[model samples]
Target: MASRARHGGQAIDGRDLKGKAVISGLGLTEMGRIYGHSGGWFAAEAIRLAIDDAGLEKTDIDGLLVNQGMTPLPGMGGVDLQNQLGLTNLRLLSSMNVGGATAGIMVQYAALAVSHGMANHVLCVFADAPLREGRGGGAAYGGGGQQPQPRGMRGLYTAFGMFGVNARYAMAASRHMGMYGTTNDHFGAIAVAQRGWAAMNPLAQQREAMTLEDYHASRWVAEPLHLFDCCLVSNGGVAVIVSSAEGARDRKQPPVYIWGMGQGHPGDLNRAGWDIETQTGAPLSKERAFSMAGIEIDDIDVCQLYDCYTYTVLVTLEDYGFCAKGEGGPFVADGKLGPGGSLPTNTGGGQLSGYYMWGMTPLAEGVIQARGQGGDRQASKHDVVLVSGNGGILDHHCTLVLSPHPA
Candidate 1:
């Protein structure tokens, strides 16, 4: 087992700090829309519930973190949230912005800070109503309170463009089904499998069961990626509370320890940065993460990879050593990722089925698995799990390895 490296009675080396920080509590508002709640109100509800879950008061929180909301409210920063929540004093704070990777990154940062005694307890919050945003449903302020500048085609695209780039690069390597018998049907299987899980989750946005046929017939958001392959905008908030393992054990729920966590962003836009054809980016983050947990890929029982697009999951599967490069398509075939498969994934329906708080929901799902609250979709309930988050066209990535307490 990987033990925390201690120097003069203090843990060192980011990867080896096992069971130092634990998830003491979890909370979420109903995933879909709230007819009466403003965004701030929704956020407050999540925070209050989390504190209650942790069996602590807002006064216990000495650190604060908030997900970057799409629209900036009158007072929407760390200080603003602190004042609204009545947290007396905050020792550390930030608004970590890595898009979908925010929640996992926040947890990692909190773990390190708490382990080092920089702060006692840290609360991470993610709340959003993307549909209320201008592009999807909210206000479009344009630029300088005026119309957005014309970047021609680039200006028009949103998440669509990100997927476009990932798909284009993925297709370039695979050559759109040459030699191998892979087709979009293989990708649809991923969607179908997730929807099956979502159907059982009352919290999922699109709980209607989908067939491979349904996935194929869906409109094309981007070539090689159908509408179903993409995550939908949702209005909801999720919260997690992290504290020292000793304190977590006294909480209402079983503590899920942060065994390993790693993040990597090798800044490279061109081909030299990564090989889209080979689907290899930097594996250093995962290597560090797995090493931290003192476990290997074979030791993990479930995975909740960031699946903004099917291609991203495929790439991550290979990069993380779940399957050999280019084998992800075949690995997911034949209903392998669903209820009884080897790797029961996205038990909360993920961003695909559950709420989309810029991917915070998926991180919550990972924590859900570690605590064995997977309900009907629970898999092996094994000791170890690996959850990954990808942001900004796979530009930013993080991996978290969680394990249940040992008897």
Candidate 2:
């Protein structure tokens, strides 16, 4: 298959993009709320488990990547975490504030660190509690956690409303729905397929089987988006270990090679309708990513694109060249993404069912899928998997291509 050209414009100018990194370990907490532990506790637990999975001690991990601003529980910030975890001597530590894309960004950063010899082992962790502690009541929307409501326009209050703004624009942009050959059913199919996969995994929340009828009858969230279309505000932490491919010799689990990774920041704000291909300033993060991986679309055995909303996944499919422009709806509807199909996606149920650890859960899914760690029900003999994340209303895109251990 021909390599998908870079977003068709603007040559990339950055560090060399040819070296390979490897994932040596993976760790994650349960999806639902664990009442006693705080956010920091989740982070610490994830890190500890990830290190143990790698068959290494805490001293083996020198780099730390996490997101802190979420769930204002005690010890949230990166430095606070370092102090809390007693890792004050650590070398590289940074927090990814890109929201949903935090996990993907953390992966990219850790890979870069390993490739450059900045660190021998990088531990990436993601954790948070649901808005309402599974009592079905908390700050389900505005940011996260059980915080008081903001009557007037304020800080996090404004950030909470930002998604509503994105939804409004998405609804307005629906005028092109007919142009794209998309429909509510297309979105429903994506949701149902994910829910099906979630049922197989013991970790997913909404394991119950869903039908098209159930989807259509579901309550509305932002119009065009049913209640099931959006992810739940559940709590959990997920982590992964990264190391140089050459150094994975003694690892307990098979190492999944990091083939290629890239992130994009479209210059447009939430309201703009800029055509990504034609616009000079619109960053083609996905294009650069595919180029770095040196692979074609058909080479990807499975994919996990961020699905904060249906449109997020749709626009990403088009932007990333998964299909021609405006073809995501039909591309996903062809029934090739479910079991025994061309590409089984979200085998872990995704944020929709598995757990809402941002898109971190999807990143873990990609890692496990590439490593052949997925159990019999969702596992297939696939080598390469594409994990993509969307943050802040499609403003930032992160793509990582992973391959099973080399022969």
The candidate scoring highest on lDDT is 1
Q: Write the per-residue lDDT of candidate 1 for residues 1-407, one digit (tens) a residue.
A: 23545789976555548789988878888876545556666677888888898888788888888875564433645677777888887887787788677888999999888888888779998886545433442122112222245355655544234333435434542542453455787778788888888887878888887899999999875566677777656667788888988767667888889999888776655655454443433375686787677787888888888876655666677788877766777888878777777788777777666656765776778778888887887776658878888766566788888877731
> Residue-wise lDDT of candidate 2 within 228-346, one digit each (tens)?
77776676778898887776766887888877777777656435576432221112665566677677777878878787765565666666676777777888886666666677877
Inter-residue clash pairs, candidate 1 = 132-138, 133-138, 134-138
TM-scores of the models, in the order given: 0.86, 0.86
The regions of model 2 sitting more than 4 angstroms off are: 1-19, 73-77, 133-138, 142-181, 269-283
Say what the RMSD of model 2 is.
4.7
What lDDT score belongs to each candidate, Candidate 1 first?
0.72, 0.71
In candidate 2, which residue pairs clash? none
